[model samples]
Target: MYTRLGVVEYPEIDTHRTTRLFTTDFNNTFILFLQLICFSGSLTKSSLLEAVRMLATYRVHRLPVIDPISLDPVGVLTPKRILRFLWHHGQDIFQPSHCIKTPKQLNIGTWKGIHVVYPHTPLIDCLDILLNMGVSSVPVVEHLTLRVIDAYCRCDAMNIAMQNEDFKLKINVKQALEFKTFATDRACAVIVSEAESFYKVICKLVETNVHRAFIINCSSVIRGIVSISDVMKAVVLEPGSHLNSYCISHRRFAEFLFETPTMETQAEEVDNEDTKTSCTSRSSSRTLS
Candidate 1:
């Protein structure tokens, strides 16, 4: 049988309780049966820059943009969507010289106190880290060399749930990495050298469809991590020269953000509504059983 994923918004459910439930019972359950916690935060009549900042600050992939008064989800914003939007419109606003600088020179991304996991670390521990650290993924490094061998991400949990009963949380990081070869959708560690241009790093992230890239030195020791948020900050919120130029360019961006939904977005909304209905029906059936 194939597993299907669905989304439902439960505003009354406690996020802390939901987290505790996952951490304690994750190994014994199917992910589809679990109720996803409500979004940690939401936007109401907010600016595009604010939305970008919120996504970066929270280290979450997406946030629901809600109606201020009704508190209903109007749209969902994600890093990938934001990046794609910027890529299309950035050429007109972003200076070529600024975009070409190295991430090191631009001082983008987390340079100090980076989090990592070892090959022998338990998969449960890694999930805990993702929960507590508010990051999507952590590099899995070799114990002796401290070299990044792979990544452990939030999506890996779903992949594990979809696998045969042999897969369990008791597995180590190394074992978890083995599953990536079979699950094509799993996010693998994307490593880049510190000297690579900022633009190149953006291209890598977009092409690979990953949230972050590890920046390593000659010996492959990680120096920092570059995330999509960091890229957005660098392009739109850069310290001095680019700020004024971006302000003028952001008008068009703001207009784009508030424009009527396209056919694609409408379709997505309909799909989400259908999924919510389906999930509700399934939940009720299980309760009766």
Candidate 2:
């Protein structure tokens, strides 16, 4: 589950240590947050080894790039962010030597200062992030440092949604007509807030023996994800809650069908002009046998 990305623990700067190279402030102190922003061009991502080492060695949660004199969170760095990035973008996030574009042409991935969360955010906000933005997690900010504090996932809901046939059958009867697709979308993760830590995430998942967790931020804003994998890595050293009963229940329910097929009425096969036009509009590829 561990990837060569994002942050570990936030480091506490020893005020007693003397150094002209480092700076200090309230943002970087409390909660082990990141104050300095970090960035590497899409091509520079691989070159960030030194920077990643600096943050890990210091136990800093995030590091953002800033104006030498005026500190601004132009870009932020966190372990979770790096991990997710690599998982989605691949390990070549910043490998200049691996550029695939033609020479003299700069084609970088479209990245923006997005998917950031504020300090003291709530879990519900993260739920939106997972569903709408399709991200696994968001960054928590202190003094504008986009550090990660929580993550959300649907694995929890999936467990609940995939439960007993009797329960699922009953619920499906009522809600099946409303789903956009004929596909099943049983339960979903709902993050309550920043107060919920990875501990809550694990307990909820283990208690449910489900793999996903729904996350939301403070003020009930749906921010984005925190999955079982995310929780496992974050809580790797901790004693996890066991879900023996839940797992048994989950196993029993895992046999349930996910998609409820829509009943098709038996009608005489006929193609009206409109139907013919619609069919023609759909792209079809033919292969020779």
lDDT of 1 by residue, 1-289 (tens): 1111122333422221111122212322322221111221224434567666656655557676644444456878888888878777766645575556878787788887677778887766676677777777788887777788888877776665456645565667788877763566555689998888888888888888778899888999888899887778777655333322121223333333335367336545655656655555556544422
Task: Give candidate 2 regions above 4 Å deviation.
Answer: 1-177, 180-185, 208-210, 237-289
**Clashing pairs in model 1, backbone N/Cα/C closer than 3 A:** none
Displacement of residue 201 (Cα, Å) in model 2 is 1.5
- Candidate 2: deviation at residue 86, Å? 26
Q: After superposition, how far is residue 137 of candidate 1 from its true place, in Å?
A: 0.9
lDDT of each: 0.63, 0.35
- Tell me the tens digit of each residue's lDDT in model 2 across 81-114: 5544444555333334323321112211112334
Could you list the CA RMSD of all candidates, in the order they appear?
12.6, 26.8
Compute the lDDT for candidate 2.
0.35
| Worst window of 10 by summed lDDT in candidate 1 | 15-24
